[model samples]
Target: MSPKASKPLVPAKTDPAAIRNFCIIAHIDHGKSTLADRMLQLTGVVQPRDMKAQYLDRMDIERERGITIKSQAVRMPWEYAGETFAFHMIDTPGHVDFSYEVSRSLAACEGALLLVDAAQGIEAQTLANLYLAMEHELAIIPVLNKIDLPAAMPEKYAEELAHLIGCEPEDVLRVSGKTGEGVDALLDRIVEEIPAPVGQPDAPARAMIFDSVYDTYRGVVTFVRVVDGQLGHREKIQMMSTGVTHELLEIGVSSPEPEATKGLSVGEVGYLITGVKDVRQSKVGDTVTSANKPAEAIIGGYEDPKPMVFSGLFPIDGSDFPVLREALEKLQLNDAALNFEPETSTALGFGFRVGFLGLLHLEITRERLEQEYNLDLISTAPNVVYQVTAEDGEVLTVTNPSEFPEGKILEIREPVVDATIIVPAEYIGAVMELCQSRRGQLEGMDYLSEERVEIRYKMPLAEIVFDFFDQLKSRTKGYASLNWQAEGEQAADLVKVDILLQGDKVDAFSAITHRDHAYAYGVKMASKLKDLIPRQQFEVPIQAAIGSRIIARENIRAIRKDVLSKCYGGDISRKRKLLEKQKEGKKRMKMVGTVEVPQEAFIAALSSDEGNAKEKTKK
Candidate 1:
């Protein structure tokens, strides 16, 4: 017999004790989504025919990439010990860039399924997420997934997971997300192990908005976890953060699908649709309360995510700026970590300097904007924030290379991160060598097992922001996993490399690199611009320089129109005079000539294609 009933499990006024709120946390491609599908099937929330791989991953980009970018919440019904329980399961993204989403999900849940791939054992990100879960004091249910794989060492990994989580080896549950073996028992274990949420049911209506998304047809759809009291449909709700009130047009729970609910009470998770079209009004981590009877205190919200990578995102067509703004506003509602501000580039035109958590975050955001909003965009090279201390005893924050202070005769501090890498013991030498090459300082190393080793390093953010991860994976033969967090900033010998075209500085091509690599960076950039920028009517000198010192230079020779071609039998003096006239005209043109860098050139030069190609060649 099935473990779950065919009908809806929870009543309208169900007791809070019967609700179990939890999330599944794992490393990238560790079967979190597949396990989620199995649970939904076991609970019969999604019928067999309607089921698809990565059901929780709704966007095409997510489905294609086979990675969860957003945390999806679903309510499943399970019969545990003759009691029908409503399980609010949040399947979170496992990538390091999306850790902010996991953190937000943890705040709403009481437990997390710490899933380890039995074939791969524990990874660096797995440990990082485990620490986050522990910080939240959530019950940790150790789960070993992919047990059916040929290389799966369930017993070995079970012990590894047990050692990490301070649990017994046998206590680690084994399950195959693909075949659905042992999933039913895992569900029952969730009921037994995870605690029910605790909230005051008698207080004024209060719900914590963990996430919100902008819907074209429905306006701003906010996902909230009811912390106390009850919120019903058509009630006027006020945002505790903004004090803005709006009518709740719809209230419902996602049983893998949006099913209308009359109201949401304490400990229940549901979505709310307010008539307000503005995405800013419904903020994530904001408290929602009844406008008439407001709650006394707001829930402690999540700390704002600090953006680690900054890049310029400009529309290929200038007219799409407003559309890009609207799209960014909507995307921000979905991804709260994304930050942007208006900035103008002389070469790239008007655009926004967007901040992302990492390279993947920047890529995903750009792709989403292009795919979802139908806007063509040109993105500049990704960079990390730097602190420039001037000789005047003032510190300035620089996000873009163009903003690097001029005449700065003081220290430059660059952001650094404490990076943790887990790899096979044999690859330790290669990993260490790669780290050292990127100016990484070894902090510590430990043996996770007889064959697996964990290495910690403190590295500058700018060094790894480009291709460090790729290099690590290549050096380790894809057996290594990495996780990192900001470790403040350290003073570094850094210089800003400015790209000048015909003696004019191009802000879009400027970059801040370590002093040691400034020459190489300048040379490469100047060479690339020489290939990208077309030959002008006058000779254009592409120079990469630091202050008055020219480190590297490339020249785009002018398109010469032969004056002698028209003169068949001219006198030598006449030819000389004509050549002199031509030379003088060229000099005059060079003086007044303004190099117009084509849009394609800007796109090609700024794109990550060259960097990726270099990484590929290294691999």
Candidate 2:
């Protein structure tokens, strides 16, 4: 019989001991998705004729970029040693910005497969994710992937991986995700090595909503992991955090593809649909329980992800403000970390100041907005949140540089991060020099093996927000990997630089920068504006200023009419009279004329902040 038409794989009361919940954790481009495809095939969840690569990556962007953005869960039935075992597998994103997704997935699993590329070995994000898994106390099974590669160094990296995880080299499993070599053995190991989930199946129905996305036809689809009891289709449930109740309309599992199931029991993962249209009703990290006999306590361990970078997202057309708001609301339903609020700029008019986890997140969000919503947008230069303390002792949180206080300021604190960099031993000097140039303070260093070294530094978040990763890659020849986390705020010599056209400040062009580099920033902005802004009827001076003092200035020559051409061979007095008259007219025009900045100029100048990161990522 076809899998879909067969009886529910999850029986009404299956043995919890036969279920193993786990997720794959690795660095970017390390074959996480490739391995997932192999497992799905081996389990027969997806028919061979219908199989495709990166099967779990459903979004077009994910397939194009060759990166996993969202965490995808699947349930597969494996027949091993004369018994059928249900495997709940979650494939997570490896990028540092999406580490929050990995954390949420980790909370719902009992084990993690730490996959390391045999050819490339361990990276910065590898250690960062390892720490996260360790924090959750999950059983980590080290696996070396890409054993089929010509440059595969399984023995070398196996020892390195084992050393980091405090395991013997022999314990690290080896497999080629490309050719399916040793995949069957790997699946058997998963069943033998990983422990089954433990929970009270007879208790009140409780599940944790790890993720949720809005469906246009069916409303909100929530992905949950049953923690203590069984959740049946058509059962009434209540969200513990919000106290909102809804009846479950459909319940199913994604066996590489969505298939209807009778219900999900403890130690199982599946999707729940309540047919609710409001996106706010279903939230990630919220606990779901039976409305009639709800669990006594809510499942509360994970914290909401905080946005580390802030940028203003303004539609090119002013009338699209409401549409932009709606797009952001729907996007937020899919991305819990995204945050935005209505903001107005004198130059850009109506827009929203959006917060993102990092530069990658910002870029992805912008692309989705333009592609899916069909709205033209102009994004301001990204910045970090700053804490400003005034002379009156009141602290103000400033997400946009335009919101910087005008009065006397006591101190400005910028967010700092604890950065971890892993590179070859030969490039240690280049890495250290680059870090020092960005105002990084050395914490410590350690040699993971004979050739690999790990360096730690505490650096300001602003320094690395733009093109720091690109620079590091160039300096180290694309061998260095980086991961960082916010480590509170540090008081610094920071000042807000304002770009003024004529005498008016352009709030969209404002930025908060270190006092030491403020002059250079001012000069760059002044010169850039000089080239972008067209010549007006009267000379328009572009100046970059700090409070009352101008640090840099440039002038756009006026477009003057030639009155002297008509006075050829005339007396010097006649030419002088005509010149004076023209000069007087120019002065009057300067006094009343406003400098009109073209939308193209604003778009170019604002997006210029992206620099090398944009180019490097594209390649």
Candidate 3:
């Protein structure tokens, strides 16, 4: 007879329950997702072999980028102390650009698992996110991860957490997400230490929509944390902002695979299906109340995030303009932080002025728009917020160069950013040199460990706004990590360098440069403009100037004769059509006096290579 199969042990649901609503918060690549996987395995939520890396990062883009773009929620039934509990785990985005999304994820939870790298300790972004969690009054369970690494220093990290968050150092949990050591104990502590949801569930349905994104089939999926009462699937709900009422079609707790639950109670996070045709209708932070029985309105729902970086996104091909616009609209449905307005350029054709949270956010957005949507885009140089005072004493915002007042006889303020860089101690000297070259002032330095150093810098936002992270990575051989925060505007000696093609000013090719590097930057920009701007019918003089002073000049010699002077037999119509298309293309180009310039001239003129080349040639 076959041996009787042993009965699988089932966790008891009575007595001390195992349910814990919590989220993991950490800086990018500090092991938040890795630790989450380990937690699932330790709790028997997923087998060790069945587990995949960043399982919650289900989006194709997220998997390719190895970053969590959207917050994810998972339910794991675990047993501790002879009682079963449902652990609702939320994984949040680590980058500061998605801080708003992180806040929304935190609002849905009663507690947080603050994951700090044992060797790296607290970073600037980590501290920033931790503060956001504190504001929500979420109970924090500090965990020091990466403890298995040879350089791990759990005790020091514990002390840092104690100092930074006012938590006890001895009480900090040290666990190796890689080796899965001490993970089981951390799970037990989460059930024992974290407090349960306490809001009144019998009250009228009042849910807070923290973040939302558009789906093709699902329409709008709004992530809400029920503050009071209960929300069930197919229940009628009204949006406080727009007063639009709809029935919840489907309800889930997270993205990708939402748990098809009946209802979500107080302090529970879940998604609502309102059949919202547009994502803007279910705006993030909008209050969702019952149409029949409403509760006290949620005031000051969410402040509109101010975009710091601005740029123009145009299509490379003029005919693809409509496609680009549609792509942007689709992207906006998912990304609430992205702001855009329809714009047209003589050189770039149709485009839009896009606002982003910061430089990284801008790059990521552009990359996604192109890669995900399969659209070719021509992006103008990124710009910072500029405060300009008019001649009549009226202040105006100037994000684009064309909007700048021609005769601003007053002060101009440029955005400043607080930057932090962490690097191996051996590369400290080189890193400091590069930062100083970019006009960065050393604020202070903290010795993170015997081999690593964290340096702080107060830098002009313009200096490090472009390619600074790339430069830092290259100099440190990919060992350095950088994080920055906008430090408001500061009065600076700034001048706009205009690059002229064929002795005529191309407004789009202008950039604001520091007075110190104006000449060098101008020369480099002029050279690049020459290379990118196709040689026109007439010779184009690429000149860079600061106000009335000419700083640099390059000449893009015009094509002497592009037309075939000798015509062949029986090909006149085809050749004529080709010539007509070329003429139409030339009409799209910006004609600056005698020469015709392409759209790429504006972009190339803003590059550092042109400036560097000018410096070399001058020397």
Best by lDDT: 2
The TM-score values for the models, in the order shown, are: 0.93, 0.96, 0.83
How does model 3 score by TM-score? 0.83
Error of 1 at 73 (Å): 0.9
Better of 1 and 2 by TM-score: 2
Cα lDDT of all candidates, in order? 0.90, 0.91, 0.76
Looking at model 1, report the run of 10 residues with the lowest lDDT sum: 1-10
lDDT of 2: 0.91
Best by TM-score: 2
lDDT, candidate 1, residue 575?
Answer: 89
Cα displacement (angstroms), candidate 2, residue 529, comes to 0.8
- Please write out the lDDT profile of model 3 over residues 330-444, one tens digit for every residue: 9889888889998876566788999988776887888888898787676778888888877899887888877777775487888887888878899999899999999888999
> Candidate 2, residues 184-233: lDDT per residue as tens digits?
98899999988898889889999999988877777888999999999987
Could you tell me the lDDT of residue 353 within candidate 1? 97
Q: Where does candidate 2 clash, by residue pair?
A: none
Question: For model 1, how does the per-residue alpha-carbon lDDT over 456-507 read when each residue is reduced to its tens digit?
Answer: 9999999998889988988999999999999999999999999999899999
Candidate 1 residues lying further than 4 Å off, grouped into runs, are 1-11, 561-581, 611-619
| Model 2: lDDT of residue 133 | 95
